[model samples]
Target: MHYAVYFPLVFGAALGLLGPAAATRLPPRPATWLLTVGGLVAAGTTLLVLAILTATLIGGHSLLAGHLHWSPDVFDRSNPVPAVVGAAAALLLAVLAVRTAWAAVRSVVELRQAHRLARTLAPGDGELVVVTEPGPVALAVPGRPGRVVVSAELLRTFDAAERAVVLGHERSHLRHRHHLHHLAARVAAAAVPLLRGLPAATSLATERWADEDSTAQGPRPVVARALFEAAVRTRGAWPRRGACLSVASTDTDVRIRMMLAGPPRRRPLLLLTTVALLTLPVLAGGEALRDAHGLFREAALDAPMHSTPHPTSQR
Candidate 1:
């Protein structure tokens, strides 16, 4: 029961922490691979259904065929309850995987489109600045004079400190190449959807990282304040749609709360957590191997042991 619960959770945590890094690095290609390969994987799923059917026909599990068998037990038996529960979990995970992959795909398309548009949209060789969006929006379009955008609404909503913080946030993002981080993150996820959370965590961390640099002017709260204010004012205004920072879809509450709280306090606690995160896979793999060995041992014990036959000399 403990393994049943904790196994997936630890797996999820691993994905959560690792996902963002991948998302930040190679987002689009990974996402595309996930979609294509995922589709191919779906085709192979019939093998699972066939395996289950064959299992039912063979009258339960066997090891070494006639040489070994496992004693039936409540948990050891192929009960429908566990099967149903497992199926449900698999389904949920599949949905999550698909959603995350799609998001990466879309982000890639949008970002690339933004890049192409930047050429035509370029205002000619100065620090990158955007003027189209009405609300708060910040984008990093590559090339010297690489622009960092902020919506008019954002400027109207925030004080000078907050506005400066917002600009700085975008600047930090550009300077640190957070977009590349995002691409990496997406790539990792596309490579493995079970690792979806990896990208998500990275994205959150990068956003925070950018916030830290942008708000370095005295109070970091000013940056957080700007993010919250922008989200509230923009209502999820995507720049492609002629709008900037729209709060319509942003995690306004979460961003604001983080702003108020400021950055997380670093402590040795994170060291322990990092250790656990790094070691969890090995632990999980070990546990799985242990369980498999145990099952096999039981099967071996149940099967008949052969006695050595004595060879008779010519009598």
Candidate 2:
């Protein structure tokens, strides 16, 4: 087979390098979707490439034995994939599968734990929780009925308008199910290390999504001020357990600038560019598989056919 079989690996590397930059340029909602979808595609293509490679090895061995009547030595010499390489690929695939499973299970367990804690704290009221604590804390806890937990310090730190902004931001997190997006990104990254950029990028996008939602609810300045004060108060403090989404979690400067700049305008060109970048990998992978299949067929056809002597006596 030709090097087309390696296209998926190359495409994955390109995504690892460039996906984050593309994600950052788009508006928050689209950017979030881009990260989630791109991450999934990248990881899935990597697995597909590995599967193709494994199939090539098996098909080559079978063709040489059945069609060409070739010895193991001849088969090994003719095949593009060496024994060591095929074995290594198989081993790597096993490792990735195990890791992906572990990550998925761990994520589910943690999410359940977070939900249980949230229920224990505020079983009566599913919407909001006001904790009496000296340090500032604000977070959206995802559960059966998601809750926005804010510390008394945080409540005292902001006026009614600022409180509205804070609540609005956390509510957006719950409404949009930002935690699931984050979990999906994490699972994809775990499956393929090349997709590691996605989880962080998605986190930023979700935070920005909430920031924009808060801005929509009230004055931009008030939302920005609320974010700034929350960050200042929570600086260096440990984030609360079950805090999947929080006002103070992301980069304060970037979030503040985004709010002050007003809502993001739709950028058709940038969106199209991101879509193209993500689509390229799938196209390349499909083409590679096609080429690899063609090569395998050609190899099979070219194999020497041994014909048995006909029954001359019977004729």
Candidate 3:
């Protein structure tokens, strides 16, 4: 295989290293998009390289080559990947597939439960659903129309403007389908060990995106205050599961500071770098595919020569 196949691993590590900081510091919408896209590209490229390595190794074997009409001698002579490396790649790919499948299934089940809850909260009602509970709980439940569920007690605590901030934040989550962004990051992270931090970074970015959206309904300080209060109220609350959107899902301290800091500057350079990172792996994967094709073509061309018996052997 070509050396280019390994480039994605290095790029993935670099992206993982930069992901958290970029998710936190960049503009919320762009940051969410950058991290989500970066995670998918990195994870997908890693899988592609693994598949290529495994295929090359299998194709080089005599038994498989005979069935496939290729010359094992030619393929083995041309194959640059070590047997041990190929074996390890195959194992890793299998394990990642199992784990990713489990994660995806669990996420889907939880999302369905949230949708069910959304329907039960207020059937035939409009977009908003206010339920009475002792403690404060606010979340955006994704459904056909998307429902914003908030505890009645929570609403009573806020004045009209503060209420607007809370409603606006949750609405932003529904409006942009922020849960899907979080879901994609989560599934990708499950496959790539280097990307373990990616899900948290994505969650943080989504939260910030909602916070910024709330600014349209009220002042930044008001938005910050409302979120801070929600965090305090839900300090010891149970953690949210799946793609559910919550006001206090991430760190309130960082969000409060962000709101007080005014609007995030749009970083064109940072965006360009993110785009480049995503593009490089795809291009590298294409090159690796071309190399693999060449290896197989060369093996096929040598097959007939290998199969023909020498006159000396025929006697």
Candidate 4:
């Protein structure tokens, strides 16, 4: 039982180490989905293992009262779990609880802040908002009736083709709800420190997704050039908002390189590999918990009886 509790953590660490390589091999859409889903599953399984460990500790303590006659001698046995291990599990569970709460509260606060900012943006025709700002700002703000905001400077800076590319990119983000995916990745990373890099990877992938989308509407070079020009023009000038998904959020150099290379081909093998990696740990954890439950049950049944009644003399 004690050893089983570590499986999820070990798997999470392994995924964290290997996930980047996997993401690189996959195309934008698959890569984004893979990272987001994998991070979520890893975090969820880690918490499940922690919960099982905590429950086992509580159950052991209750059973010990009957088995060892309320004596501290129960610690001498090492079948169910050692007292030292249980104590450590309790401490870890406490820390995880606090961390999870903090992450949830922080996510809520950021959402509220994003909504407030969205309210302040002046409405424009349809989903477009042309902010009268000097900076070359362009972003997709996600919410009910999501809006694509472009600054006055941005409109004036780009030509017709470039503007079309920009609109296509931001529209892709709004249509696909890329911000939700980003938010989920962020929350998962916050919950599981091992997956801290996941959010960044997903962000890059989302940028690529939008890039591909824009390319569908125009020449690849045109879209790539638009992204490069926007990135350069808006460098160090755009406002950082939690609620807005911007066209220039990812690494400009990487995006340029990917765009120049053209859209990636689908790699089914990579997807299969990623699926296997995610499934194995969950199955192992479930099997371990099943075995641990059986062991605990047997231990309970074998506990020493408090007293034995003398057999009555037979007639």
Residue 109 displacement (Å), model 3: 1.6
* Backbone clashes under 3 angstroms, per model: 41, 0, 0, 0
Best by lDDT: 3
Q: What lDDT score goes with residue 131 in model 2?
A: 84
| Model 3 agreement with the true structure over 1-315: per-residue lDDT tens digits | 668999888877887899999977799999999899988898888888888888877988888888888899899999899988889989999988787788788778887877877777788999998777668878888977789878888888999998898899999999999988988887888778888899999999999999999999888888889889987875544336566788888878998998999999988997887787789999999888889899999999889644577889986
What is the C-alpha local distance difference test score of each model?
0.49, 0.77, 0.86, 0.76
Once superposed on the true structure, which residue ranges of model 4 sit more than 4 Å away at CA? 2-5, 62-80, 123-125, 299-315
Q: Which one wins by lDDT: 2 or 4?
A: 2
Model 1, 126-218: lDDT tens digits are 555657565456555543334666656656766788777767766675566555555655554553455555444545555556555665754
Poorly placed runs, candidate 3 (over 4 Å): 236-239, 305-315
Clashing pairs in 2: none
- Say which prediction, candidate 1 or candidate 3, comes out ahead on TM-score: 3
Error of 3 at 275 (Å): 1.0
Whole-model alpha-carbon lDDT for candidate 1: 0.49
TM-score of model 1 vs. true structure: 0.51
Candidate 1 at 218: error in angstroms? Answer: 4.0
Better of 3 and 4 by lDDT: 3
